[model samples]
Target: MHVPHHPAFPKAPRLPAASLPLALAIPLLLTACGQKPGEAGHGMMMPPTEVSIVTVTPKEVPIEFEYVGQIAGSREVEVRSRVSGLIEKRLFTEGNRIKAGQALYQIDPAPFAAQLAAAEADEAMAKARLAQAERDLTRLKPLIEAKATSQKEADDATSAVDIAKAALKAAEARRTAAKLDMDHAVVTAPMDGVIGKTLKEQGSLVSAQGDSLLATMAQTNPAHVQFGVAEAEQGRVQQELASGELKLADKGFNVKVLLSNGSVYRETGHLDFSDYKADPATGTYAARASLANPDGKLAPGQFVRVLLMGASRPAALVVPQRSVLEGPTGKYVYVVGKGKDGNPAAEPRPVVVGDWVRLDGEVKNGWVIKQGLKAGDQVIVDGVARIFMPGTPVKPVAAGAQSAPPAPAAKS
Candidate 1:
């Protein structure tokens, strides 16, 4: 047959069949070497990947404010003596609860007793003198009327009676003063509370103005907490109050105290009062809360944190703190939104945050998303650091997607 101008049927003699196989293999190997790592030997391209992602959910979020404060007794007083004397005995045991008007200490009764006794004696003598004066006056009045003696003599007798009456009045005044001095010998508690350390022991001399204090008494039932709020944040607090963001009942706000070890106090307190003017030194306002201390867990000068949670926001959504990530500039999260194809797509959205609102945080500013995120979207909380990337495709695996299932226990 006649051959056309093709290389396969060239006029030159054909190579061996082995050489032909080799020539074909060389082009095939070259093609494999020239291809990208991901592309197959046939020049097929790899498709975009699909990654697993989480979405942010939106719900009513009730906002609250937390502050650091101090625990104090609602009614705290230092027990001291009204008059100067030696402390004879301390009646109430230290660190024990006492009642109002309870006698706490007894001064030396000897001095006070002697003074009262002397006053009584003086009072008795004054009465005797007054009796004699009355009798003399009675006699003088009749003498003056009858002129039995000279009018001048009767007048002198009346004057003498008046002088005796004046002497009795003077003696009676001394007795009253002595009795008052005696009553001050026994010191009593002004109010009901728990007694604290005793500064003066038996035989210790205490004066009315003595630097030495007898002891301290603190009301344990309703304790007080002193807290400070920054001056700049006044506007936010005012708005919350005026707008009823914080709903105080007929009483006031319900307060919770947090200790340094993160334990909640047993009792709830109420917001008692606020300072009229800002503190000149701190540039913050002082606030006081009355806390119940039935167990006496809190005391004055103890530092703690305060939470105001009187209102109820049942519609609010609470999320675990681990779901959110923080940055130096602000806070942000990766939310999975549905693409046109109904596939989940992750997008980075920034948010403004307010005071931490319990389990979930406050979104002071709203978050914007163009993808499939919705109110009830699911978020990947566990595998966050591994696969969170914006506009990137990934072969995503849920936190424990491939873990082997636990084998069933051996049949009994």
Candidate 2:
């Protein structure tokens, strides 16, 4: 067959099947060679990442121990009836402040009054009988002296007078007891405090024997906060104090409370009591702090967060909490160090932490470094997320400093 070819057209060359893969890879290799040095996916070398750092230095850092506490009244008393009677009137309102000796409830006084009247009548009859006996004894004594009556008769009269006197004394004692019962018909508060809801209402029967609890009262002016210190934590604290690593305030711990809403309480307290023995179930020692709560802001049974201050760690290294990272092994932090080429690099350092503290000028709390970090170590505080691997080059910047823009991309 006869075919004509155009002058402007050109034929393509064919490649062997074995060489096809090599021909495809050659272009990719050439493209890879054209990439800039130190670029990602081309070489191990990478540009330095900018990060904010904090230079750790040993200093006296204040230590605060926090615990969950419950508010309580300094004195709690139960208002009870001293006499058995029906509650006629409730003198005080429920959930109100009351003064010492204030009338809480009025029992039915009619029964007590009747008993008192009967005792008085008995006493009157005994007094009349004693008068009559004494008159007879006087007459018998004169007759015995004049020999008109026998001496034995006079002796009998004397014995009768003595019996009447004894009866009169017994009646007076009964009268006094009846009067006391009458006075006790009015139930009074034992101390100045805030009263709770009355357990016994009007027309409720109360007795002095057992069922006499009318209401409860609590003294809230000086509120007490009760908390527990774990046995392990207590032991560690003692060891630190003994080793001179921690020092306590001369006057003891100053306590402050945080409300549930994250607000600080106005009044501060002092540690007043600590139990000698630990609780078996919780493995903690009970402790208490006293504070003035004149406004009654702290109510009984309310929960609060207690901060124990006035203790400090001397010559301790600290780092921001956010800077610390958790790994498969344990907690660690990134520090600025010299790389193989003498440039700054991020180095992972394992750390053992102690108590937590809130330092000045820091928004978040910090951890006290017990080991693995020392003075003059520059820890990466901010831009921690930028670090992808250990020993990667990093540009350390002072915390809170603004970094200059990248020279407008070098005007490329």
lDDT of 2 by residue, 25-78 (tens): 765765677744334553344569999999999999888899999999999988
Could you tell me how far off, in angstroms, the CA of residue 374 lies in candidate 1 after the best superposition? 9.7
Q: How accurate is candidate 1 locally (lDDT)?
A: 0.68
Instruction: Give each model a TM-score.
Output: 0.70, 0.78
Per-candidate clash tally: 4, 0
Clashing pairs in 1: 337-371, 337-372, 337-373, 338-372
Runs of candidate 1 with Cα error greater than 4 angstroms are: 1-59, 149-166, 209-212, 239-252, 311-320, 327-329, 338-343, 359-388, 393-412
- Model 2: clashing residue pairs? none
List candidate 2 segments past 4 Å from native. 1-47, 122-169, 361-364, 402-412
RMSD of 1: 13.3
lDDT of 1 by residue, 1-412 (tens): 4534422111336779879988677667667688544445643543334434343454444444689998878888888787778888889888888999999889887887898798889878878877887787787787678877787777777777788778778888888777776877888888988999898999999878756478988886788888998987777667765875444455557888989898888877778798989999999999998877877788678899998765433333333445556655455555555545455555455544444455423333322232323465554444455432453333344433654455888799
